[model samples]
Target: MAEVLRLHGVRKRYGGGASPVVEVLHGIDLTLAAGAFAALVGPSGSGKSTLLNLMGLLEAPSDGEIWLAGEPVHAAPDAARTALRNRYLGFVFQFHHLLPAFSAEENVLMPVLAGRGRLSADDRRRARALLERTGLAAHAHKRPVQLSGGQQQRVAIVRALMNRPRLVLADEPTGNLDTHTAQEVFALLRELNREEGTAFLIVTHDPGLAARCDGQIHLQDGRLIEPDGAGVVTAAATAPLTAQ
Candidate 1:
């Protein structure tokens, strides 16, 4: 598989100077190969979300290097970073973040609309297809308020895929759903990973969901702990489903 994302000796600090700084990431090195589905698991304030933000290009690192699709991007300009993120990265947060006024299909097209100079017929078709894939084709005409929590979240997933991003960053994507709904969403994301070969780096607190991933990176107090070979399990290993 190809390397979709890589981070080397990355470090982040909120402030600077003596008594003027707090480091969030402590020389972290990580990578995600194309078509891989991985999880980041840790306690609150472990910096998992912070790491995701940096990886997604929403925040800049205080030090170290990052490469996306083999392109060095840690020092890229704001415009370049935004362009790269728009083209190669997709994000799904805990909240659906859908516009209640827009229909499901329209919401899914939001990214496509923002990227292109203007919306076109092909964009609509792609959005429709994405909605269909998420089992939301029948609900495409409904607004977010009209759909269940699961349905709204599924729309968010398709919207994230509007650009066919090389990497998908999900921050507790299933955190807001019920046990059954969370499982369904997780299964959907995994299916898309297999079908579209989109790499995933999900930040989740649920051990069961993390166990189902290709691999899980555990973090504590802003540091990623390398799991020992003995307890590590790949995505191929069947993980027992646990209630949320």
Candidate 2:
């Protein structure tokens, strides 16, 4: 399978001038193949968020390379990085972050509208189709305030897919839902991954959720710890880092 995302020798650090530079991520190396579903699991302060930020193009790495869809984007200019992020990446966070005033369909259309400044008939059709796929067709006209938490999250997921991105980065996507609702949402994500062939890198704290993924990438104090023959490369061999 072609690689959807790759990171080599990636490192991140904070504090430069006055305070001591704190290296959060050490020479990390990882690769996610096309259509793969994986979990990024680690304890608090393990640099999971920092690494995800770099991969999502929200931040730059202090060292090394990030190749998304074969483009070396780590050193790209801000405009280029923004363009690449829109073209190749989608994001879902713990919160739905939907506009309270917009209807479900309109919320799903937000990505296209933001990118193009206007929506076409085709965009509208796609949004409706996604809503239908996720069983939200009836709620298309409902505002976020009118919908339940799970419904709002479903709308957010649909919005992420509006651009048909090659990869989706989900940080604690099901973190706020009840156990049953969380399972349903996760099943929806997995079904979409299989049907759409979009790769997923999900950051989750739920052990069961992580175990359900095709593979898991464990991080500790800012380093990757992988099992042998796990099919992922790391900077160095280390003791297994269990999910918290």
Candidate 3:
């Protein structure tokens, strides 16, 4: 598989030394291969969100290297970073964040339209197909307010895929859903992973969801503990270090 994302010695620090700077990440190294379906699990404040932010180009790392889709990008300028993220990285947060004013199909095309400033005939067809794939073709014309929580989230997933990103970073994508709904969403992500061969790095607190992933990276106190030969992240080592 291709290497979609890689991080080397990435670190983040807030405030200056004179202001009692607080270090959030400690030069962590990580990677995600193509078609990978992995979970990031840790307690709150473990720097999970910070890590995701850095990887998604939402925040700049204080130091180290980042490569996405085989290109070195940690030092890229803001505009370049934004372009790269829009072209190669997708994000889904805990909240669906769907625009209530837009219909399901329009929301699904948000990324595409946002990137190109307009949609093509092929883009529309692709959006419709994605909705159909997620069993939302019938709801394509409905607004988000008219859809259930799960359906709206499913639309968000389709929107993320509209750009055909090499990687999708999901921070608690299922955290807001009920147990059954969470499971369904998880299963859907897995299916898309297989079908599209797009890599996914999901941050999840649910033990069952983490276990269901192909692999899980555990973090504690802004450090990524190397898994042992058995590939288990011990409870002590898996606890989150910070909520910030």
Q: In model 1, what are the clashing residue pairs, if there are any?
A: none
Q: By TM-score, who's the top model here?
A: 2
lDDT of 3 by residue, 1-244 (tens): 4678888878888998579778888878777777788889889999998989999998888888889999989999999998999999888878999999999999988888777898899999999999999999999999999999999999999999999999999999999999999999999999999999888888999999988887788888898876321322211222323446
**Candidate 2 C-alpha lDDT tens digits along 212-235:** 888888889998888222542223
Local accuracy of candidate 1 as per-residue lDDT tens digits, 1-244: 4688888778878875656667777777776777778888888888887888899998888878889999999999999999999999999999999998899988988887778758888898998888888899999999999999999999999998889999999999999999999999999999999988898888888988988887787777766676422322221211222225
lDDT of all predictions, in order shown? 0.84, 0.88, 0.86
Error of 1 at 189 (Å): 0.4
lDDT of 3 at 24: 88
- Candidate 3 residues lying further than 4 Å off, grouped into runs, are 227-244
Question: TM-score of model 1 relative to the true fold?
Answer: 0.91
CA deviation > 4 Å runs, candidate 2: 227-244
TM accuracy, model 3: 0.92
In lDDT terms, which candidate is top?
2
Q: How many pairs in model 1 have backbone atoms within 3 A of each other, for residues 3 or more apart or on separate chains, i.e. clashes?
A: 0
